[model samples]
Target: MKLVVLGAAESGVGAAILAQKEGYEVFVSDMGSIKPRYKAMLDAHHIAWEEGHHTEANILSADEVVKSPGIPETAPMVAKLIAQGTPILSEIEFAGRYTDARMICITGSNGKTTTTSLIYHIMRKAGIDAGLAGNIGHSLALQVAEAPHSTYVIELSSFQLDNMYKFRANVAVLLNITPDHLDRYDFKMQNYVDAKMRILQNQTADDTFVYWKEDEHVPNELPKYSDPSAKCGFTDEAQPGSAGYAANGTFVVNAPVHFEMPLSQLSLPGRHNLRNSLAAAIACLAAGVSPEVVRQGLSDFPGVEHRLEKAGTVNGIHFVNDSKATNVDACYCALESMTTPVVLILGGKDKGNDYAEIMPFVKQKCRALVYMGADNSKLHANFDATGLPTADTHSMRECMEHAVALAQPGDTVLLSPCCASFDLFKNMEDRGEQFKAWVKQYGEAK
Candidate 1:
């Protein structure tokens, strides 16, 4: 079999290596320059590859193509492949073919990383030899090739789900559906929603489907056919039949196993995290993890980086890096968690953000707004009317400097952009690292 992999980065290179290991003739192509590590990996494997351009002859000859999620359908080469009816697969789908690992796949506009990490922690604590993959940790294909495990907790984005066909999750977790990446979905909310729903594909009676009961879109879009898999819902309120919820300062689970714990015992912050905790607990329980183990794991899980991570405290002021909050809903989650007055660092590549959703939090919690992005006009226009103090800058350094100036004792300087990081940084991780670096220096100076 001939396999051509697109975008020679993490997922693409992983796919190539797996294909080679599976005895397929493999090739990797990236329109952009391949990272040195990935380039070396391809060379070490003796796989044929091209960088800076897609060789049509080499790519078109493939029996199957595995594409990185970042490569959209609109790319002319991909369109040609589609037109020719050549099979196109996501790395997730391709990887699933070779793994007997039971999959716990989590997908949503928000809270996916937290939920994925929490579930992985619980499984590990319960003595399950589970691997983490998909949008986090190592690529699933790479893990299947080398260090395979009995189970996997994967973080699936809508883009990754779009190309996944027959892959089934033993436990599917849908946190919530919100308007995000609408541009990639052709500006249609339903398109984005449909992409998220693909997580439930191929689920069976023995499988379990976990979702947010309160999300406006989730309940409406669920299949109308007589239910097969155990359908469980998580919410802030523990309804009569909910799989998980919070009630009376307790985290409660009623499905797979009955479990309860003091809500105050959860290590993560905010009401959103409470929902995340509920989802993770229910998924872990459905996977046969004991309630006691689940409770312990939830209590001990440290938290994911760049998602409301604590940088440091200087003379009482706190610095938080929530660089992963790349959309309005995510930003709302960060702001909602803030107890102290916030000097908010906001702005990035705006993804058609509706600032109105966060206006209430801004009014109540935000003392000053520091904007950082190539374009801040939209941010300025939307937020200026609210009468909040705002500053505009083009770099993280300036953003942090403004934050330090605006913040007082007992205040928080938060880096929750509510927008994509492409404008001024390579990605969210880079943005977060710069924030942490500058914040460390800023704190030491005080």
Candidate 2:
């Protein structure tokens, strides 16, 4: 069997190794440059690969292709493969074929990371064996091939969910869906929502589907036919006759195993995170993890690095690295979570962002705006109507410098760009790391 691995990054490389180990003839092809480390691995494992181009002959000859989640199905090569009747699968799907571990998959627009991490933390605290993979770190295929665990908590993006067919999560979570990655989804909200709903595909009546009851997307667009025998809903706004909801400064999960936690004690900030934690707790409960473990995990889980991370303070101004705020809705969560006045750094490759959603918060909490990106004209057009003070910076350093000068002692300089970071930095992680390094020298906050 010939397995062609598309792309040569983490997921691709991992898939290549796993396919080769599975006694298949694996060839990794990347249209972009493959990192030296991954290239070295290919050579070390004696696995064949080609970088800088995807050779049509080699790719077309494969029996199956393992695609990176970042590669959209619309890519010409992918379209051609589909036309030729070649089965294309995501790294997660390809990996799922080798693992017997029960997958606990989580997906959503805004809070999937928080929820995934929260569930993993809860499992560890509860003394259950679990491994984290998928959209976050090590490729699931690689993990399952090398060090298999009994339970896997995987973060599923819409792209990953798209190529997945029989890879069902024993307990699936959909935090909430919103308008995001519309360009990839044909600018249709339903398209993206439907892709996210695929996390529950192939799930049996014995499985549990966890979702948010109050999200407009859930009660409206959610497919009832995809119902697992059990349903658990998490909400901060809904009345909880059963399941979970937030009330009186606490999140209450009522059911087979009663759970409640003070809102203030949650390690993660923001109402979105509160809802995310609630959803994760419900998932853990459904998985049969104990309440004590859930409580400990909710209280002590270290938040994801790039999502609303506190970089440092200089001249009494705090810098927050929210490089993960890649959409308007994610940015809304960052702005709404601010306690101190914010000097928000915003701009990037606009993914058809509708800035109107965050205009109210920008006008109220934002003391100043530092627009970072080459094409910040869209922000200007949308923000001009808001009358918020705005200035432009072509680079991240300039944005940070101007932000420091403009910020007061008790204010925050938030690098919460409401778009993808490719325009300025290599990726969100690179952007976030640069923010952290620069803030280390700033002598403002302890």
TM-score of each: 0.97, 0.96
lDDT of 2 by residue, 1-446 (tens): 99999999888888989999999999999999989999998899999999888899999999999998888888989989999999999999888889888889999898898789889989988888899998886778878878889999999899988898878789998988888888898888888888987877888887888888888777676566656547777668547454787788887888546978888888887788888988888899889988888888899999998999988766677889999999999999999999999999999888878888998999899888889998999988888676666788988678888888778999999988989888878998888898888788555333
For residues 70-132, what per-residue lDDT tens digits would candidate 1 score against the true structure?
Answer: 888999999999999999999999999998889999999999999999999999999999999
Instruction: Kindly provide the TM-score of model 1 when superposed on the true structure, using C-alpha atoms.
Output: 0.97
The reply for model 2, stretches above 4 Å from the true place, is 223-226, 237-242, 444-446
Q: Which predicted model would earn the best TM-score?
A: 1
Please give the lDDT score for candidate 1. Answer: 0.91
RMSD of 1: 1.3
How far out, in Å, is residue 132 in model 1? 0.6
Clashing residue pairs, backbone N/CA/C < 3 A, model 1: none
Show the lowest summed lDDT stretch of 10 residues, model 2: 220-229
